[model samples]
Target: MRQEFDEEFEQFVRRWSPALLRVAFLLTSDRGEAEDLLQTALLKTSRHWSRLADRDAAYAYVRRILVTTHTSWRRRRRVHEVLLDQLPEHQAGQPREVEAGRALRALEELPPRMRAVVVLRCYEGLTEAETAEALGCSVGSVKSQASRGLARVRVLLDQSHADTAIPEGAR
Candidate 1:
């Protein structure tokens, strides 16, 4: 039985690795950090595989690790960091990339939990209940985080609009 479960777990990890990496990328906005975060999450998940009651909950469990891991990483960086500009280059004729960059900046400004909630709910298209499960938080908290995250993003975008002179009707 244990061996069977192990095989199943391996298969699950293989199948979900791409999706998990994508989720991690959305959370961190850095490819290297995303890969590291996903690896750490998967390692932790593997350690607890046998104890996990519902196999289907593996994704949520791994995601929770990602959220917490990212939060810790960000917290540590806050204590010792200087300002730096590392924005990605936008392609010509790709207005969407510019908008995405603005949104990404807003996401980076959000608190870690709020960022995870927003990414899971909006980017990953997870339902509130699923997000709550993945975040290991109450649905109410997820709702609040989602609301606040979206509000903050909007504020950031609005500020960008005011700061830039891209014409009134361009966007």
Candidate 2:
């Protein structure tokens, strides 16, 4: 029975890790931190495996754990900034990459809970109720946060675009 439980959990991890990692990456905006976050979530989930009566709902359960854990970490200021001697050079001519970088930077500006709400609602395509459940918040809170977060992101992106735009007739 113990071996069966272990195998089941392992298979679930193998199947869902990629998707979960993507969520973590969006939440953290750093690949290394995302991996760490997902690992921690998985560990927590495994510990509660026996209590999970519905295997079909495991993904939702784990996702809720991920969001709560991330918000808690942010509250505790567990994330650290590493200073580098020099900035890395950006490759030119990749419009998508530039846009994605801008979007990520915009996300970084949001408060942790708001950022989680936006990522789960927009990027993950979760409905307001689903996002609220994941964040352990009321649906009304999710709605307000999503609205404000998206507006802030748009403002940030527009500012980024303006800063990078070439002057008219100056090319």
Highest lDDT scorer = 2
The alpha-carbon deviation from the true structure for residue 103 of candidate 1, after best TM-score superposition, in angstroms, is 1.3
Off by over 4 Å in 2: none
lDDT of each: 0.86, 0.92
Query: What's the TM for model 1?
Result: 0.80
Tens-place lDDT digits, model 1, residues 84-111: 6886565789778878878888888888
Structural similarity to truth (TM-score) of each candidate:
0.80, 0.95
Candidate 2 residue-wise lDDT, 20-107, digit = tens: 9999999989899899999999999999999999999899888888888888888888556879999989898999999999999999
**lDDT for position 82 in model 1:** 42
RMSD of 2: 1.3
Alpha-carbon deviation at 16 in model 1, angstroms: 1.1
Among all windows of 10 consecutive residues in model 1, the one with the lowest summed lDDT is 79-88
Ten residues in a row with the worst lDDT in model 2?
A: 73-82
